[model samples]
Target: MGIIRTTVFTGLLTTSTAAAYLAARNPVISPLAATDPIWTSSVFKRHNPSRNPATQDVCIRRIPLDKIRPELLQREGDLALEFCRGVWSGWGFAVQRKYLDLKYRGPETAKQLWTNEELAQSTYDRGTCIADHFEVVEKTPTAITVRCGDSPRKQDPRPSDGLFVISATVDKQREEVELRLKTCLFSSEGTIQGIKGPMPAWMEEMHQWYARIWSETGSWRLLK
Candidate 1:
């Protein structure tokens, strides 16, 4: 059988790209800062050797972090905040907190061990919790690291290392942010052979563009 023709959908995910400064941080004050044009414009294909019909399909969405509603941001931060708040509450301290810190001793996933239902609910209710600036920069995605701003120096227990770093700017606070975004749609599932491969012309053109862009746009940032 030829590569199964999967019904895929693509759309604009979120905000656009832009630069801004902290409105509150005046001239005399120091300013803290940080911060895809794909699909529809381009086509990506799976390159595998299996000839069987593919099993799974994927949808690609570019979630512009900048445009996400404040309510949405708050909701996303809930679980993270609760994890941190829980740590403080257990010690009988109930002051306002802005960040969450989590760790696991043995070999296990960080999210699985850190998550708790009550903590999640508490974090959402507070809505006051916001991740620090440093958090965003460290979390942005990179092709090399997958997770943006992730320092290669640190080690992770997650066996498969395939996460994308997504970051966005919000408000005038110059709060840099990073998120490891994932979707079931990005994966190439089912019969490997049935998966269509990149067109020869597109592959050749992409390599040429990559080289040109890297040379012109990525002087200090070497892309491989």
Candidate 2:
């Protein structure tokens, strides 16, 4: 009887430990902030007055700061910038090398940004291909916003002449910090209407996949 009781107790302890470990690995996410202005104001509205914009929100992860030193927040900010810039490449997406120059992070001067040029090669995905221009319309220590639109050089407007905005923000509250990514899609192009149902679904899938990739590999790169 003693031997059997000891074996049962050991198995129970092992199961409890495994459950606790799983809970720690997946943290809960809390609300961080309202919709940003770039999404609300800048996207496709400039080109098509009647355009209705759609937003997709992805709560990447909530990081616990209790064990980490306070001074590391600056490092976190830099990591956030790197994550934003490298996300597309890190995900192994098909991207044209020429347009990669538009992924700048810091403050931008008039000439240094892609305010009036096409974003990247036409070989990019359909939604991305419509992004003719990109500019760093907003930048701060904790947040960065990139605006995308149609080429200013074009005389006639194409239905694809819409706007897409990507914003990354770091919000710290008490013992935890939240990193969130928000994207807005505004398109006037007639072709987009046909793919509207699948566009958002695809974007959400890509966003979640990138988040997992960042959590597994990119976050560790920051620590190194």
Candidate 3:
């Protein structure tokens, strides 16, 4: 078949031109941040012996949190959550979520357009992913660890993804906040394309494409 569509984060797989398409028009923020996005993965040989190295996906976007539009959040909302939400709220991922919501029988009740408070509550309260399609594994002022298996689709997938952590760390020295999106896939019985081991290079490239979108979306929201 064609490229195997995968990852709640890999929405760009179907639409490869999304970045180029969106790039034509100017967004609110430019240059993203002082640093470029970083993508890395490891199997955690000691801790996660059964984990697949191909399963872990980490996307990092470093931007100045101080430069955010104050009007976007005034109440007791976490900026970091908003940053991560923006990554999910990006066009490609949003479309995939909505499509799944329409196709699935048990569509989640979470709002597609989230408010700052809603995100904060979802994370800090450790609410079920259905409340919002995110499961809070851990939370701090600067970082929040979320799992992909929050909803039915993810909980039951072709090959499931694992823990996703988003961090918006403030640094006085660097004068920018680092927004990192990390996901380590948990082992399951399923495998894509009869390959029980690592995925194809195209799949890896697709992962990198979407990872960059995480920062692009975050940057757009930072200015919007």
RMSD of 3: 9.7
Candidate 2: count of backbone clashes, pairs at least 3 residues apart or interchain: 1
* lDDT by residue for model 1 (150-195), tens: 2222333211111222222233354422221221112223343433
Question: RMSD to the native, candidate 1?
Answer: 19.9
Report the C-alpha displacement of residue 195, candidate 1, in angstroms. 13
Q: Please, what is the TM-score per model?
A: 0.19, 0.45, 0.58
| Candidate 3 residue-wise lDDT, 5-94, digit = tens | 124225643577766643332122221232422122231232233444434455555556466667644543466766666655554355
What TM-score, to 2 decimals, does candidate 2 have?
A: 0.45
Q: Pick the candidate with the highest TM-score.
A: 3
Query: What are the runs in model 3 whose C-alpha is more than 4 Å off?
Result: 1-54, 70-77, 105-124, 130-134, 149-159, 188-198
**Residue 158 of model 1, lDDT score:** 19
lDDT for each residue of candidate 2 in 68-91, tens digit (9 for 90 to 100): 334445563553554344333332
lDDT of each: 0.23, 0.39, 0.49
Q: Which run of 10 residues does model 2 get worst, by summed lDDT?
A: 115-124
Candidate 2's C-alpha runs over 4 A off are 1-39, 42-49, 66-82, 85-135, 148-174, 188-221
How does residue 129 of candidate 1 score in lDDT?
23
RMSD of each: 19.9, 13.0, 9.7
